[model samples]
Target: MIPSLKNILIVCLLLAALPACKPKTAGPLPPQIDYGQDTCDACGMVIDQPRFAAATLLVNGEYLKFDDVGEMLAYHMNHPEAQVAAWFVHDYLSEEWILGETTKFVKSPTIQTPMAGGIVAFADQAQAEAFAAERNGKLFTLDEMRAQVHMVEHP
Candidate 1:
């Protein structure tokens, strides 16, 4: 028995739709920030600030862009749906992306963020200390920062 003409067309349509239904693997993240344009994955805000921008690279190479380091931390703390392979944040002074795990974060009311997160990233601990000295901010590791964000959300 031969397949009907309508059945063949339906099969072709189904085949074409399969790829669209599958989760696509994204390419590497952009090397630099596109301030005032990139949308935050956590809060849906525009990432217009360089110093406060943050992102997490998923294991599949997809990125979850954020407007603030604290927002990123809060998202990671609250969301258990996805695991991040790596994380990046902008340095307050340089406005360049740095490894979030290796960077030090300073959180103070004086260090204002886009979302009022009051978090800043620094490449050097001394620089963080200096920033803290300048504003009485407390320096924290990424883990510590995550915990602090968790506390705020959970408590």
Candidate 2:
């Protein structure tokens, strides 16, 4: 038996409505790699590098982009205590990578910033004084008693 015009119209409407029955979420496919191997230089740990992990730190409008783990570690190591963070970007050139930072070779162990208070211990008072003078800071030496003992009460 032939279907009525009304029934045919209903069937056509159902077919059209079928597409809207299920919702579709659209996005680019997930990145194909495990980013856990990425490391941090300052804090000395691994970084979680993901697309949603975007962060920006600017200085005087001259900005440095450190979305990847390698860049962040480099920034942190040089800055030492600078409030910088990083993640990992896949380097197609050299393949294998770890947490690292770009650093200039310096003969002395000077703190990168004035705000950074680094500990430099010496065996004698004179040597400590000399080092402090060279570095432009107050210096102290480990006394014979304090040298042997690990902890002491500060006056």
Candidate 3:
């Protein structure tokens, strides 16, 4: 039997709404920070330096901005139970947001970060190595930075 016109329109409308019912997937990119206006979620300091900015994306889609990479590490370390969807950091040279897991890190006392964290991120390993060598800094991976922060907090 053929459906009535009203029933056919209802079916068409339901089909049109189906896509909107699908679960929304979060994007892999990090959220933009309002530099000089956005305050760090950890230290409450203004995030004026794009090169030194860091952020954590929670599973709930909350973006926690930080003034320094070390501050981001420390925040996560303290909130060990927080569900983190992703971590992001700005490339020291380009000031572009990069996946923290794929970025290289350098830590040195003389690096002079915003919060004196002395941590900077690089999108290129060779560049990170060169920066480390030039400033007597040590190279680290994302896990190493987290571990370093954990040690400092726990000890």
Candidate 4:
């Protein structure tokens, strides 16, 4: 038997509302790394330090984990063809994940990161500034970090 018009309308409304019922997501999320077990995609070193850990989310939904923030930048520099969606780094103080683009970075030999990357991320600019001042490091934005990677790798 054919459905009534009222029943069909009800079904249609429910279908329309189904999408809204699902939880909203803020786009693609970074992957969780199993420290000491997970290895850096670029350097092939075990990612044991949360404060120095970094990751890149590619457009294809692949996560490239890194032992150091500088390694992540170097990966992108070498693989310029990579289609990156987002970057994630751990705040040095909190060891919490933060968007790399919006985060501030400090670079210095004194930082003592894995693979001698010497770069650390911070969610707060003030905190980064303080860290840089204490370590005699230079503050860098994401773009500047990319350029700095070249120098580190080449030199």
Candidate 5:
């Protein structure tokens, strides 16, 4: 009915080792974004748009959510040391989450995005082309986002 000293010590050691039990570098963690209540991990602005949301899984197994993909980019640009495990963005057309690096992007002043970045993502080049054609926008690859991100105003 009573616990022994040896049992207590064992339990304490197990509790302390629990942190070490987490998987390391086996795979990237999934990104989590809370629609309205979540603040942009980069600029501390509330993420209100379901259309322009972005999030990334850091190498440390932490998630950084953003109101705009531009905010996410600005953070990475400013903090070049950030270890990003995976990048994700919401498709402006579908509001669906997709891998950021593989997705096509368009920058248009006609499209009003959070942070005034005016950048949008699409899962396919055709989609990006169609969107850009209708809006007179320019298309870019993920690697090119770093350059367009300069258009976003930093907080």
Candidate 6:
């Protein structure tokens, strides 16, 4: 026998009230990173080896990372059109690192720029550009950036 109209309505209401059978989100959004070895996927250079990776990890609100700063410099040097970018670093403090999963892949990187006619290193992009624009200087080339690294800083 067919169920009564009240029962059908109740069943419909219950189904409606229940959470839609939508699939649960799988996990945290995947970071735009290459957890691979310390190498720039774009240029195939060892990351963070020659220089610390410095790039805009958040570009237009999107997560990003460079394998290292050298690569970021190289990329911008090669392509001056990049508006913003990101870089990845190993997370020694993460629990995942303890589990052997490694938190080295990047979700985003802090943005920075070169400074002082390539003489000084500024911690922010605006400073670098201001110095460059005001002084009639240009951004450091990848070679220049590499050459400026002090042995004390790396060692």
Each candidate structure's TM-score, on Cα atoms with residue i matched to residue i, is: 0.75, 0.26, 0.79, 0.82, 0.76, 0.31
Per-residue lDDT of 124 in model 1: 83
lDDT digits (tens) for residues 1-155 of candidate 5 = 89999999999999999999987774444466677788987778889887799888888877888898778888888877778888888888899888887899998999888787788899988989999999999998888987767634455
Give the alpha carbon lDDT tens digit for every residue of 1-155 in model 1.
99999999999999999989988765345345577887888777788878788998888767888888888888887876668888898889998888888899999998778888899999988998999999988999988888888523422
Q: Report lDDT (Cα) of residue 94, candidate 5.
A: 91
**Which 10-residue window in model 2 sums to the lowest lDDT?**
98-107
CA lDDT, candidate 5, residue 131: 95
Task: Give per-residue CA lDDT, model 2, range 1-155, as digits (tens).
Answer: 99999999999999999999887864212223334764333333344534211122333322233333323333444553444332222221233321112111111236231112233233234554565577665532222211222221112
Ranking by TM-score: 4, 3, 5, 1, 6, 2
Model 2 has a clash total of 5
Residue 126 of candidate 3: its Cα lDDT? 97
How much is the lDDT of residue 71 in candidate 5? Answer: 80
Candidate of highest TM-score: 4
Residue 23 in candidate 5, Cα distance off native in Å: 16
Q: Candidate 6 overall Cα lDDT vs. reference? A: 0.39
lDDT of 1: 0.84
Task: Give candidate 3 regions above 4 Å deviation.
Answer: 1-27, 150-155
Residue-level lDDT of model 3, residues 12-126, one tens digit each, is 9999999999999756878889888999887788999899999998998888999989888887878877779999999999999999999999999999988778999999999
lDDT (0 to 1) per candidate:
0.84, 0.35, 0.89, 0.89, 0.83, 0.39
Model 5 regions lying over 4 Å from their true place: 1-29, 151-155
- Quantify how close model 1 is to the true structure by its C-alpha RMSD in Å: 10.6
- Quote the positional error of residue 125 for candidate 6 in Å: 21
